[model samples]
Target: MSTAMAPEPVDNGGDARTRRSIARAVLANPTMVTFGALAVIILAFSALAPGLFTQGSNFVQLAQNVAILTVVSVGTTFVIITAGVDLSIPSGIVLGQVFAVQALKLLPLGEGTTAFDATANQTTALSVLVAVTAALLGGLIIGLINGVVVAYLRVPPLLATLGTLGAGLGVALILQDGVNSATYALDPVGNGALIAGIPNLIPIALVVVIAGFVLLHLSVFGRHTYAIGSNPEAARRVGINVERHLLKVYVLGGVASGLAGFLSLSYFSTTSIGGFSTANLQAITAVALGGTSLFGGVGSIIGTLIGVWIPAVLKNGFIITGVQPYWQDVAVGFVLIAAVWFDQLRRRSRDRG
Candidate 1:
């Protein structure tokens, strides 16, 4: 009875398998890492400036602050997923704003009256709608041209967008007669808070993000985008119209940029020619930081959502903590580098496995 019983067998293989499965899951969803980092940053900021960072008003401000960037980043996400770069986003935003404002100024709402003049020839709602439509059309035309050049003409995306960037800015400048700033009487409506101290920009941004998620994750167009990005030849072999799909992706990006322009015009009640110079860089950086691969074929809209907020939170937190504005750029640069490095490491790990 006292004899030693047989030792229970160790389930080393099972344990190892479980561990591998967990690792695979983590690797498959890189957003987990970005989300974790965002949480940490928030916590750190809260700790650094407890009263300031934790305030309800500050959070609302942060939401309104990042609204424009979030909208633009959604479009940038699509282009990046296709392994294409668009340098024209900033120009697109400017164009949209300029177009909207110019339409309000030039379009004959009534006899010898423009939307800006408030002559009562047209209802405020109709004027806003018409101007918004014109802004969107401006963006659409630019996007279509970019897509045509890149997809059908076999031009590189970077070159095509860069060319458009210059051209778009020139057009916007011409429309404004080289004026650095232009304002409209509807500034209050455009930038006013709609609900609970939240600016109208927030709701518009939410709609864009939601629509982008649906388009990217739940639509056939999204599937083709991923396929084309992953392997164009394979996608072509499968009868996927690669060129047409690419064109659509660019157009979508353009539309998003246009939407952002409208929002910006509303929020600021003014269009500044040089105000959004850094917009393209910020959008691309946010996309990359959100776990979207610059090499294409791997991306997530949810990740982009989180990515757009991180920099915004950082800048806000830094200001509260008395950190210099320039340092924010430095911090963002490091984060960008770290994100790319992580991507490289992940790629290497997959290759080895």
Candidate 2:
């Protein structure tokens, strides 16, 4: 109205500065952004569903839902850090579960022959040892095969893991006659609570998180892992023994899957042979969404933990909010793709600068 034309439209470059600031902040601590997203989801879901999503019991349930996943993802986080994939994680987990159950049969548990007929009272220390050992060995074997094929035989990581995925599951099926077995040998570990009666799974997961954090973030082994993923040739020239280190990495991943299998059996009191078919994809998605580059050399235990929770919250929230179940997959897919794209973009920017 005053015909001043807003002083010819001031252009102070504040928008550019703000964007640059955000980019710098994100570049410095990418995990923070993912955590922020998780926080937002929690808040949004809590708001949308009110008391349902914010209940203490629901959170405990949420923790239980993700505990096994958190355990399994520890080694997976390392694998991705080395720029490798372990598609056989689910099979490895199932094998562990199967091994634990079969080992239980060798004990005097007196099962009544039903799929879930075993009781918690039948659990014994010897039975526990057998189950744990069997599960760990089963998972470790799968990991070893993957490591050998990928490291020495020059098979691509994807193909090697894919082969093991089917093979491991097949072995499990053969051992169990394609049926999930039951034993409460791990019931104490699975359902027992410590410190204020928290579910045992959460504490077990917390321990794994601590161990994984130490292994991946604070040790030379972790450094070697990042170096290998960042530049294998350079890592090799530096005497990193890329092949052996990779083998160890795959082994570690297998061990983690095996541990997850044991924990899963403990929690469910049965082998969930058909329950975790998509678990590998879920682990990959969590790792990717937590800012680990698919191309490798970037990730963290904390990030993976948060990544595990995002979808868990979404599914739980969606149910509470009456959203269609399929939308959860659609939402998670979009988030994962966006994360990977942003990761690629960040990588390009780093290379350029």
Candidate 3:
């Protein structure tokens, strides 16, 4: 003790502070954290279902399966980023598909009486375009009505969309005359393969994602959207037209759903009323999982892209591993819960810092 000086300080506090800083940085960006989670899931599935999960064909199939949902989720992302929810997405999608098919039927292009005739040479490219346009118009009308109800009438988004959800389904059923299925001779968007074995749907979805990213990240409208979601009163005080913006957001959502309907028709060649039973839940779950806070104002399209794939991979993995279909829902439920929990934690940490 007499010969030795006191041991130098270990500086353990400094190291601990550094570690805390790293953790906070990682948590600050939900997209990064979600990507990490997605990577872990992929690795786990690769191990559990080694052959099929990682195969090229399986990847293509996964892309095809998720394309419609991805398109629909884009709209959901827009609505959610503004601190709003649209329960009408599923209905919007179904209505869009049904309307497209009916348009083809009513405006047959050639010698066929029904749009579903394989022998009919009636499906011209122009007819397809017109049918798709009509479907999109229907979606726009529905979205506009929702906007008016929520913005002008001051109804909450949930209740307003909930009413529209039922109305949409009712309208779809009436259009199809309660038919369980309807077919069309529209050209298949999936008939050709692109580079890396990716189908046309992949490119189409990429366009949607890129467009959405630009709209939300690079445009003034995106800024206003964030402002409103972060605080409506404050946004208004700053000269943001909250009602008009909300209306536009809803309408955008509708257009997206309509596009998804077109994609669905291309992929499946038929519109089944029961096929989209879980679509609304899936789109919402994807958006939530992508790290977009339900509370609004903070979100990313890149995150939504990752989120859409998570469920697609999960379902495909489960099916490959012989897991029951119901377990897929269970797994998705857990993912949603975990996402919300992490979101709350991040908010709290931000406040503390």
Using lDDT, give the best candidate's number.
Answer: 2
Please say which candidate is ahead in lDDT: 1 or 2.
2
Worst 10 residues of 2 by lDDT: 109-118
Q: Could you tell me the TM-score of candidate 2?
A: 0.90
* Cα error of candidate 2 at position 312, Å: 0.5
Q: How far does residue 130 in candidate 3 sit from its true spot (Å)?
A: 1.1
Q: Against the true structure, what is each candidate's TM-score? A: 0.90, 0.90, 0.89
lDDT of each: 0.84, 0.87, 0.82
lDDT score at residue 265, model 3, on the 0-100 scale: 73
Clashes of each: 1, 0, 0
By TM-score, who's the top model here? Answer: 1
Superposed Cα deviation of residue 282, candidate 3 (Å): 1.1
Q: Candidate 3 on 232-294: residue-level lDDT in tens?
A: 999899888899999999999988888888778766777766677677778888898999988
Error of 1 at 166 (Å): 0.5
**Over the stretch 266-294, how does candidate 2's per-residue lDDT look in tens digits?**
98888988888988988999988888877
**Better model by TM-score, 1 or 2?**
1
Number of residue pairs clashing in candidate 1, backbone atoms closer than 3 angstroms, sequence gap of 3 or more or interchain? 1
- As a TM-score, model 1 comes out at 0.90
Backbone clashes, candidate 2: 0
Tens digits of per-residue lDDT for model 1 on 156-259? 99999999988999999998899855556456556666575777778878888899899999999888888888789999998998999999989888878887
